[model samples]
Target: MDDPVSAQRASSVRRSLASIVLGFELIVVFLATLVIFGLSDLPAWVTLGGGALLCLIMVGTLGLLRYNWAYGVGWAVQVVMVATGFLNPAMFFVGALFAGMWTYCMITGSRIDRQNK
Candidate 1:
């Protein structure tokens, strides 16, 4: 049997780690958008609009982190971030780097949560 307080604490810790990753990713995605706008010949609206949309999604996801399904959405966001490589090849590396970070946080957080439980 598990203690409710410990379980809740573990959950809080995991959520905090996940939130940190997403928050940092939000900044990187925003900067990547600027880079894409400057380096690519795509129309201003396309770049700006797409960037704005992604940013909005990130912000929204941040609020949804308490839900398990939100983590799946986070993974989808990671895929989209990597897809941005089509607009700027550099984003492939950057996106992968962030994905690695996200993976690390998820794995580490889970381990910590389990240990706490």
Candidate 2:
């Protein structure tokens, strides 16, 4: 029989670590959105609306991390983040940095979960 306690602990650790990383990304992306607002000539509504949408995606992705598809969604989020560079070129660097962090979180978190199990 499988050990429920062990399984639960692993899930807890994975979710906790995943949330931490995604939470940091959420903040960074929000800030980037604000920066885009100020720097880009993109219409005000688009700036605010797009930023709001990105934040929503981040929140959804964070909450849905327990599901396997959430990671796929996260990668899509990363693409959108990087694509923002079309408006603010600096975000290319910022987005890539966060993308790397996200990659690390996924890889390291998975390894930790495996080790714990």
Candidate 3:
């Protein structure tokens, strides 16, 4: 039989790790928006508007992390982040760094959960 307390602890650990990654990613995405705004010749509305929309989505995703499907959304966000490289090459490196962190957190968190179980 599963121990309710252990299950809850595992869930909490996973959620906490995921939350941390998303929270930091929120800030990074916001800063990347500013970089795009200042550096790119693209229309201001496109950069600012797109950045705002992505930031909003990231925030929403953070809240949705409790659901398994949300992790897929998170992965999509990472891909978008990396794709930003087309706009600013620097973002490719930055995005990859965050993606690595995200991957690490997901894998490590799951390992911890399994151990707890």
Clashing pairs in 1: none
Ranking by lDDT: 3, 1, 2
Q: Write the per-residue lDDT of candidate 3 for residues 1-117, one digit (tens) a residue.
A: 999865684466677888898899899989989999999999999999999999998899888877878889888999999999999999899889989988998898888878876
List residue ranges in candidate 3 displaced over 4 A.
1-11
Once fitted onto the true fold, the runs of candidate 2 whose alpha carbons sit more than 4 angstroms away are 1-12
> What TM-score does each of the candidates earn?
0.88, 0.86, 0.89
Misplaced by over 4 Å in model 1 are 1-11
Model 3 TM-score relative to the real fold: 0.89
Q: How far is candidate 2 from the true structure (C-alpha RMSD, Å)?
A: 2.9
* Residue lDDT tens for model 1, 75-115: 88999988999888888998898888888888888888788
Predictions ranked by TM-score, top down?
3, 1, 2
lDDT of 1 at 86: 85
Task: Show the lowest summed lDDT stretch of 10 residues, model 3.
Answer: 5-14
Considering only N, C-alpha and C atoms within 3 Å, which residue pairs clash in candidate 3?
none
Per-residue lDDT of candidate 2, residues 1-117 (tens digit): 889875675476657777887798889888987888888888989998999898998898887877878888888988988898889889899889888887888888778878876
